[model samples]
Target: MNVSQSADTVWNNPVGRLLTLLVGGGLVAGVLTIYPQLLPVVRWVVPVSLVFWGASRLYRYGVADSLSLAAGCLLMLGGFTYASYLLISMGELAGTVAQLVPVVGIFVEMFAAHYRNQG
Candidate 1:
């Protein structure tokens, strides 16, 4: 199968999706543990991932379906930037929460979409 088909298969399959998440989480954890000093550089992974994901969606479905994705990515980038600032100026907890807000928002969006489709 082609790349698109492979990606769809993984995304559509519950086990594959879970495994993908697990692997990604593990990789991130490992990287952080192995090279703590790279933390600053690692933070950029989110926005870069967002950009690539948005670009892929735009490529596959065109601009009509990607405007929101582009906007969301931009908002996320801004949020991340602010979160980094919070980390430097505020306490660790505040900075951590700021960083996690976007992640939680994404999960909430995913669940909303899933339930909306089911109903």
Candidate 2:
């Protein structure tokens, strides 16, 4: 029940990773379709990369494990929400979708993992 074990459980399955990647990418793309500028390439790429890396490390190390993941996710969610807010404040109606993408992706990932385990 360790974090590394959990991650290995999550990652070793091709179906699970594919499911997550497809779902996550689609969600992110869908959100971007609205206010694409909300996720400026340079501005978000590095941060997103870092978050993913950090999440993986947190998962592997089990250093507060789920808490670490949750916190990272929440922090990113908050950032996305805030970015949307800023865009909205500037009179845009398409930014909130950015916040929805990863949120949905998280659920997708969880479901995929659960289903994989069940099988």
TM-score of each: 0.45, 0.30
8-92 per-residue lDDT for model 1 (tens digits): 9999999999999999989989989999999877766665565454445445545453344444454455456554753568677
Provide the clashing-pair count of each candidate structure.
0, 0
Instruction: State the displacement of the C-alpha of residue 48, model 2, in Å, after optimal TM-score superposition.
Output: 7.5
* Backbone steric clashes in candidate 1, count: 0
Score candidate 2 by TM-score against the native.
Answer: 0.30
Error of 2 at 95 (Å): 30
The digit string of per-residue lDDT tens for model 2 on 68-118 reads 455455545645564555445533444556555456545644654465467
Q: Model 2: how far is 62 from its true place, Å?
A: 19
Which 10-residue span in candidate 1 carries the lowest summed lDDT?
65-74
33 Cα displacement, candidate 2 (Å): 0.3
lDDT of each: 0.63, 0.59
